[model samples]
Target: VERRSASFALRMVVHIVGDVHQPLHAADGVDANHPGGDIGGNARRFLPDCNATNLHALWDSGGGRYSLHWVSTKPEWEAMRAALLRDARQMVQNRTAVAAMDPLRFASALETATWEEAVEALSMSGGFGLVRQMIGESAGIAESEVFVGLQMNPHSFGGPLPCPDAAYFANAASVSTQRIIVGGYRLSFFLRHIAARLRRQGLLVQGGDNVFFGVTNAWEAAPNAALH
Candidate 1:
């Protein structure tokens, strides 16, 4: 039960960490049309011609390439997984995309460091500081990139805004792809840090060719033990 709970918690943490790296998740557009705030652009609707109905949805979907859809069957799941892996590989292989995030410098540093070293490298903030820095960076991108050419009118009779131009879509796609790579790397850093701590506490063990979490030397004696 403890192992299952730990696995669930880790999955939630990874999901949330990836979400915060999305610029729209960290910012709300505020203009005369929405002095109260744009509710992260959800209040600002785009024309029907646009890929998404609102600015928030546009950024969330990466201009429709990442739009949400249901996948219930095993085959559907497998297909989605394969598509995701292919896209990830393609992004990693793209020199411009990988260079934008500097994965070699940022991800490699934390990924290679011990837990104590990571804490020291973060100036003792223990990863929270790094998460906050990521949020700030996303907010900056939201302002400069996401909200730059938005045309919000205060008196449009609740009508939708104009569809973003091709340039806007292009930039959004570029930024979203880079942020996705960075977020994945950041999540890896956190997982590696947690694994290091678990190893220190003897809750994780090096076995053959695998690192097993939520287990100790006598893990084989326990049934239904988590493997990671």
Candidate 2:
């Protein structure tokens, strides 16, 4: 692939992996109200007073704490970047507190997996096993945490949707935070794996201290370098 295409592919992988870490992304509600499915909770509305319009939006925004809006200006983008960095620092600092909330023990597995073990697993399963495990974990969380306390309206429309209590919001925030951290870790692993594969395939070359992937200049000099 061309340099730009490879970069875009990597970004898509990162984005999709991060999204899959969210419980709602891997699960949907199916009940008498809507037999087809809740479309990952998008069909179920939350109370008007809630920060999000629907169940999926609530978790997507990190329980209203990390709602993101368009940044049209450079200053706005800078501010958002700083805020994200701050939040990431805080999450890393308090990651241990959220460990108990991760029933799948992904953090532990990531920590213990050696390079050889990871490569072996990836080779054997073509990385599908890891992806499946992550999805399964998210689905389990969606069932036990996201869908457990929800009170569905008897009628699909014309009535106020059930409002999640403060406790639910708090728990959701914690779970979201944990998932974000896990997603970051997983993304890092995936990028490293991709880089290794590219190097092995002669698609990436080591230039000084930086690895250039099918590109002449340093990858850091690329316009989208800030994403890293």
Best by lDDT: 2
lDDT per residue for candidate 2 within 1-228, as digits (tens), equals: 765666677667766777887898999888777688989988888767767788888888777667546577999888877777766655555445645655546445544566676655534456556777788888988999998776786444635477888888899988777678766655555556576666666666645433344333212222122122
Q: Which stretches of candidate 2 lie over 4 Å from their true place?
A: 93-128, 154-160, 200-228
Which run of 10 residues does model 2 get worst, by summed lDDT? 218-227
Clashing pairs in 1: none
| TM-score to true structure, per model | 0.75, 0.75
- Please write out the lDDT profile of model 1 over residues 1-228, one tens digit for every residue: 254455576667656777877788899987777778889889999887777889888887775566466488899878876676666655555444543565234454574677777766544455545656777788988988999876677337567898888888888888887777666655555666765566665555454433354333221211111100
Quote the lDDT for 82 in model 2: 79
* Native-structure RMSD, model 2: 5.7
Estimate every model's Cα lDDT from 0 to 1: 0.65, 0.67
